[model samples]
Target chain A: MNAAPPPERASPAGREAPRSSVLVAERLTRRLEGEVPVTLVEEADVQIGRGEFVVIRGPSGSGKSSLLYLLGLLDRPTSGRLLLEGEDTSGFDEDRLADVRLAKLGFVFQFHFLLNEFSALDNVMMPMRRLGRLDADARRERGLRILRDLGLAGHEHKRPSQLSGGQRQRVAIARALANDPVIVLADEPTGALDTKSSGNVRDILRELASGQDRSIIAVTHDLHFASAADRQIEIVDGRIVPTGTMATLEAAAAAAKAAGTQTGAAPAS
Target chain B: MSLHLDIAFSHLRSRRRQTVVSLLGVVLGVAFFLAVSALMRGSELDLVARLVDTAPHITVYDEYREARPQPARLLWPEGAVAIRGVKPKAERRGIRQYRRKLQTIDAIRGTQAAPVLVSQAIFSFAGRDEAVTLSGIEPARMKGVSTIDEDIVAGSLDAVDTNPNGIIIGRALARKLSLEMGDTVSVVSPTGNVRAMKIVGLFETGNAGYDEGQTFAQLTRVQALMNRPNVANLIVVRMQDAYAARTAAAFIERSLGYKSVSWQEASKDLLDALTVRNVIMYTVVGAILLVACFGIYNVISTVVLEKTRDIAILKSMGFHARDIRLIFVIEGAVIGIGGSLLGMAMGSGMMRAVEQVEIKPPGSTESITLPIYWGIDQFALAAAFAILSAVFAAWLPARKGGRVQPVDILRGAA
Candidate 1:
């Protein structure tokens, strides 16, 4: 899928979700098996549609990342069905699920997780090669273009170890966008970056959802990053808690909206 | 996919030192395997050829497998007949009408057959008398079955045909009887038949016992002296394919009612020894590759352990478990191909060195080069084994890589 146009600088239009949903899930649950059986995600119903920047927020053990993984098709739900682009994925095998993820979903983990052995260009070429729509030359050109767009123009030949933390994360973002997936899933994209790099990463993620027409789902505890999203979900103890009881989160969002600024990380309790 | 190979090669190239260390194991294993296999098989084949060449490929004797039943026992269907001794009507002992049997033997394809009369006799020359085996043969036909013509040391085998009363004796026998070319020797057969024969040829076959105890003469003269004219009691047959001797001999025996024996049957113990030697060689060589496989397993398993995050990342990036497995297997294939090619070259070099080595065997003056077998089958075997071991070594870690769950690693890292 082609990326959406640059996000409008006008009033936010993400709360109105009645347009079209790219991914739909019903009562999805993931339970770990052991002597002490633990449930990671408990009957979570969610919808991620076009042009929405959704942030998953929770305490340390709230299964926020688990929910994102379930939605990203990296983890299978124990007893619920997931629909991707209006196709049922409940019966898809491992390989088929991977194909769907490759074609439809992109992921950016907390550590940036760029393959250390490969150059920035090759790392971005991975997903494009997996899709196999373009020949090698086209894939390389597409890879270089994505890197250039992400401000990694001269660093294409540098490995992850040679690049800075922010550059590496940008390379990861470039990789996520290589195949032009319908949705991007980031498990704390700015979790390990400094304040400056974290701000740059947050801005990049926001533009991805609002401007590029591609939906984004990120897991984060940063109140500032959470407040900038079109929608914020708070998960507590493997369950999604309603937004009304989370006063600090609501307070942060309202204050950031009133100030007309992009960050809402003040007064984090 | 090329992606798999691409990743595989990157992994190997990233860890260059460990890759070389692991590669050397397979290289040495394969090289030693080829070198040792060449030496063992080369020597064994040389020994077998020498043994096989020294005797006729197939020999047919004039005898029935079992004697006929007594007349009384044959006549009484239900009665028990006991006899202490039994004798049949008098009959001639030699093969009757052997010329006709020779014609039937000559009709078979892929074989050369010759008739011979073998009898024991005592030889007397000057004042010495020693027992010897006198073989009566047609010189023209005997050459097809035996290598005595090539081993002729003093005179030619063809001289027996031109000389009317010719006898070919071994050099050791000539020394024992003080007989040389043109010397007449006296022989007394078992039936008291005596004859004086002129020695026309001499042969030396490197076997002291055979050289001292065997002699050859014209078939017609032997039959006349032994009082069994126009008869041959035995036939020696040689075939183009030594391995096909059993079938050919079986055909001859079935058609002629004679006891046919192939060289294979006569030297079964020696052949069995060769088979046992092969088993031992393979087991030892297999152990070497197995050890090399363990070395590969160690290196790849360490790579898997170290690169767990890379595996998790690739899995999260939408790579299938099969892709992970293919990457590791490709790594193994790289090692297999590289090791086998270099090992064969190194092994060929070792074989050349071995071929240049000279040794003087016991009881011989001239130094001879050591035997080295160079055959293509060994190369194929070394390569097949190298690849198999390499693939097997990678299996454990590849499976581990395929089973990697990105969430666990991510959770742990978080």
Candidate 2:
């Protein structure tokens, strides 16, 4: 039987669409350590809808992280059209990019890289204080609200060194959410968590993407995590294989529930 | 901006150890500069003060090169030959007549006319005798022209005014003869005349010129002792204008025939020495300020380097380069202002301390005291130098900070 066609990603109308896609890629490519350059997403015409749960997935060294970085504006793409909210960001200088990152975007790295010197509340307030428009009371109120929202209210005064790994990651999440960013580009949000913590982080990501109406483009190699996403793009050797069918919920349910199931959707192991 | 200032202050407070070490050089340099300058200025005050004690600001004297015609001689009528074959005497008589003409000049407000007797006097007291120049002065009139009133330490000038037989002797002379107040001293003039006088007061001008070689007496008494009537030697005139003394002297010279000089001319070397001292003091202080500026530059430069990351973050967050520069400049300026004020207080206190200590007179059986002079100008200059040096010191390092790139800062490359 012929595989189902890929779903077209179009920005929703009327809801004051995201500046553009939280992540946009046209032939997004990155190269590491000598030899031929790896095309992370070859002419990968993808637009992340506002408040959409878009996931990029592939095996290790498949350029998933590279695509996330290029989209997050953390790393530059060699040759690609990156229109953040329909504005060309390819020529944006570092300072301007930092402004976009501060006012328009937030990032959740795989390692939960929180500044070690400050307490969790201070870390949450870092972006707002750095931006410098808010007074002390305002910054404190905003930081505390975010920490409480992330279920880490009691941990607000604790330093990162004083917190557990999960708590530290939650603090990082609170920090990213502090300034109320339009989009959260989390690179492997649950990549380092235990099974329970991983599910917790995944559930939070899903809620932020669907419930709170924030565009989330998370990069992950876990098929289980990617499977629950609204949409997933599988990259291999820097290119998306357009011939493969996009597996729907029915297909996913059948693959997991049927006995002696011979599945063609799983990667050829 | 106050916010940044608050931040800067708190930041410095946080790094108290480094701030103290850094500010130590500035503090010491300011204090040293202020103290030395104050002492030099004090020396100038002392020199001027001593000169002001002995030097005559205005001398109204006999401008006549020769003796003036006495009132008794003037009775012979105008152009009458009073002396036969004594042309020098007659010429002296004419010049003396001219000196009498100066009395009519209205600008001569106060005159202390005295016969400056140049004859060697054998001043014998307690069997010890020495040659001395007797300056016969009207005690009341001398107070208007010089600081002679301050010279009297024992007895009184009023006694010299009341008693014609009274004389004012120097402290050195009193010591040399082992004499005290009320002791008799015999003055034997070169004319083979002798007169005994009682010592009424001891005067100390703190200078050998006045203290060692001179004695004061009533002008009439000295005139009678010399048997010179209607004939006075040099007349020391005191006038209303201290600075105009030279011009007044020149006027007197042109009007009459005697030579007259100003206090400035009399003590030119003393004044010159004071000026040279002032220049040397400024140069020494300037060197201190220069070194302080350089030290501050190094310290502030190091601080800038340490704060480069924070500066970058500030800039990226919308702080302008000018603002960052202002922070450091303000920091330096604050250091300078603080150091200057503290140093001035310290220096002024030091001067007061010097004044409080009494140093015994060396080689003497008495005590002597000196005061440390403080002036408004000295403090003003020192304070201005410190503040200017600090601002100038901030320039180089502040410029370097302005050149820092945000990209490099975030990357830890700055």
Candidate 3:
């Protein structure tokens, strides 16, 4: 589905988002109350267009995961607005937000988070059953197809406890795509994986984003993972620091190290 | 099955031991409920049956319920007729036109009626005197109306019909007076007309009082001795359906103008006692089921506590709070219903065991088994209580599970 771009260089500007964008965050913020109040995401603005793989990269405690959660409609923003296909979601109630999450967006957490009681096939069918767009047999057929496509065909009956770490994560992804949501959000998708498994997950995610024309927004500290995305938004403290390309993210990480500050993760080095 | 039901099954299966233990609570509770109710109901029915067997269903006495109005008061309307502190004329005390009233009573369907000439008499032998209640009955009609036929241990009731001067006395009285069959005793009515009557039949009703004080004789003989010819004092009735006695008695009193008392009216205190017993039985049995409900509540609350993260994940997966609640409620209902079915079977067995216990009451010569009433409604009652307890037990934890926020769990796990 990635027809070669029509020869004009893709614009680096994100603020003037086109109508084809899937999710838009307009200066969204999230605040947590405590003895000492915390701001998880502060005034973050980003636009994710269809068929794009976008990354939010930062150091530890940089609020990248918080921003991704807000964009995915898992959490209500403290101020500013988020739009899904140009509909403002700031006023949506909790149930309505869940409906949006079920029908429009999907999620993969740092842990696989598959229900331990269910088998891999049942896990994949959970979202489809919830959405109720398909009957039981059809849901089963579609779930098997998704699992088979992700190379878990024979492992359909295996419980989450029986599957390897990477296999479990793939089951989680299969579950997320069960309803064919247009936007798939991942928070540290490779956070619990080994080197080779994380590489496998990254490649699979890249293919799913571009090959199917589905937008993917993921948060990670892995610079190598960020460099593969079409666009990257860097977070420092709670605010987004925009970047133009893979080169800009590499340059920023290099500059941080030279200036004696913690840099974005570069596992490849 | 629905998805929530499937999930509920899985959750219970995962904690099978805990589920079974809670289920045991319900099973024992329901079993005890059925057994206790059956015993209580069975004993009540047995007591009423014995009561009905011993007494006439309805008794119409010769006496008027109210004093007969004087002719002067009847004739003087609004004339300020005052007869205060005046005694009525003491006329013949027996019922007039008694043969006609007996025929009227016999015509009433679903009843057996017999006229009896009852009088207080004294039996004297060798200068020893004893008081007795002489009930002179028509042997054929008495056979149909009175349980005395069954209590006769020696000669049948027909022996008294054969000999005009024959008397059937209870064994206790025969023993006390040292009289036997073919022995003669002088029976003197309260008005002093006396005759030497031979004992032709002997009966022992296992009631010491009735055996000692009550005796039976031919109706003609008692009427002659009492100087109450062509008159009877009581008409004892046995109905086809004992419960219909009140209405029958009322009709009899209204038509015959005699005071007809039904067994139910005669024993109001006994019926009231049975009703109070039933109330206490239900309260104690209901408390058993309530404790079973608490067991269910404890188990479900623990399941909710242990599965909080799972609930959070389900909520995050677009499951509504109600769906989560439904899963746990279904779990509770499953256990409750399962336990009820098992308990019903066990309770039936328990009731059978109870029915086999033999006890001879005081002063009884033979052993009798306990009465067991087997009513299907007790099963329904037990099931209703079981399901209600289970549903209510599930509701508390279900509401808590439904209100769980995914964000809270996710943040804590992170």
Candidate 4:
């Protein structure tokens, strides 16, 4: 995989970011302290712009999900600083961080982790309820609208167990947009979905980024899914490895689609 | 209504069997607690009522609580000289100025005092003699201060006033001496005076010793027979409130300079036993609820364990640790409240069942029902303890659940 190195662009960490950037990370590192210390993410620098769709592509155990977690404010970094919308968040307490996450960030995991006891609409309304910014009627209306936009209008009252793989993934995507977050973080969003569900989830995330002006950061091993994003970040051994731009990756993916062949085996999807 | 409670209800609904089992434990605990405490408090109050009714609320004796100081000792402050082996002056063993003392005692609010001249005597009928304590009483005054009138088996206490030579003896004494009502018997006093008296009444107090040894007659007749006319040695006081006896006795003793004893003071040992019994009763009942609370702890702990993944997801979605804790705690509180309400109903039923029990004690002719006190305090206490225990049991596991780090669980699951 380490062939002729592509032209190195100026690292976003060293240069002044544009006013549209929503999340900026400067050499963020996370290490698990033990007898033999392990580094999950090492001095990683990332800058995600508003309305941008970015994908973290890497081999297994390469900290692709770890970086997503740090960016989502789900885990604190060992040594570096992160700024969300020009606000320094390294000094915020656990409760304050949770508040920021609730107000500004959303998450979609591989398993379509909807509460089993609640309906699809109820699961979608969980974030809105937690944020408490909207009234009950407003929350219900917004949840229904989001589910309807995701082509799940009639299945709003159905449980995750009752829905198909593609439908469940769509419900999860609807849940991720419940609070109309500034950014959505996805960790292997389609890792448990079939090919059709994976394509559906990728297109929905792409539309959320472009149409609603919400930034999206997803970690995936599927090259075809990565090709749909505006940018791709490759990581190896906890370090980001610069890769080809969106134009080249899209052209390659289009050719692969025409030939009905995949360039790489998808992991757990 | 709130989010945490909504989540708690959903969790409990998902595990209906376990929730019902824990709830039943609380219900049984509260029911048994109410029933046992009701019975215990009932019997204690019954015994106290009997004690108050059958005896004087306060008794003023002819003797003093303390001996009088010697004149020399009073005159010489801090005297080095000790008065040794000093004997009290001999006089008539009776309250001095009995009319004035009775008037003073009766002046106290809610109190009624009756003067009695008690002396030892021997009753002889048909060549058989029995030693008994003879009481000289005015029927009108004694009626207010004693329940002896209510214990009469034949005739009445007023009959003594109608016939000055009339005497009232216990039924057991009548049986032992082969005496009947209206029978003439000779009463001999320690003063060497003998007189013939007619039995006007017979009483059976249920206490064998008291029934066999006590006899009452008209004041003038007994005073004249004993050769102590106009001398009353004891004043028995009955009060409206039996519980006020202790303070009343103290006040009366201070005023009259005589030894005054309350029924509570006389039965201190029995009352102390009852208090110890109450402590044991509550501890045992509380322990039953405590054991039942373990069922709550088990169910909540299992929920926390099973819901770790859900907890992690909620935390990632911005639910705080306290919110997570509140969800589980609400689960505990719901069970507690539900169980308490149901338990109170069950306990009321149990108490009603206990009230139906009747028994005939040995040597007693009539059957008596068990005393079941229906005070509201026990019900409140049982419910409060059960709910508190249920909440407390939930607290430990809730704290554990709240402290669960979302990152750890998320990382492991991923």
Interface RMSD of each: 0.9, 5.9, 1.2, 0.7
Cα lDDT of model 2 by residue, A209-258, tens digit: 76666778888877778877888877666666442333443366466557
Docking class for candidate 4: medium
- Where's the lowest-lDDT run of ten residues in candidate 4 chain B? B73-82
Winner of 2 and 4 under lDDT? 4
Measured against the true structure, the TM-scores of the candidates, in listed sequence, are 0.93, 0.60, 0.83, 0.89
**Candidate 3 lDDT over residue span A101-171, tens digit each:** 88877788788998888999998888878888888888898888888878898999999999999999999
By DockQ rank, best first, the candidates go 1, 4, 3, 2
Top candidate, metric TM-score = 1
Top-lDDT structure, candidate number: 4
User: Which CAPRI level is candidate 3?
Assistant: acceptable
Which residue window of length 10 is worst by lDDT in model 2 chain B? B90-99
What tens-digit string does per-residue lDDT give for candidate 1 at A163-217? 9999999999989988888899999899999988999889988888776777899
Q: Write the per-residue lDDT of candidate 4 for residues A1-269, one digit (tens) a residue.
A: 11111112123443233437899999999999999999999999999997789999887898988889999999999999999998999999889999898888889998888888899999999988988888899889889888988889899999889999789888888888887788999999889888988898999998887666678999999888998998899887798866853335456667677788865533220
- Candidate-wise lDDT, in order: 0.86, 0.69, 0.86, 0.89
Instruction: Please rank every candidate by TM-score, starting with the best.
Output: 1, 4, 3, 2
In candidate 2, stretches whose alpha carbon ends up further than 4 angstroms from where it belongs are A1-135, A158-269, B2-16, B34-47, B53-131, B164-166, B174-200, B205-209, B219-268, B271-303, B306-308, B326-358, B366-395, B409-414
Chain A TM per prediction: 0.86, 0.80, 0.85, 0.84
DockQ of each: 0.71, 0.07, 0.44, 0.59
The true-versus-predicted C-alpha distance at residue A3 of model 2, in Å, is: 50
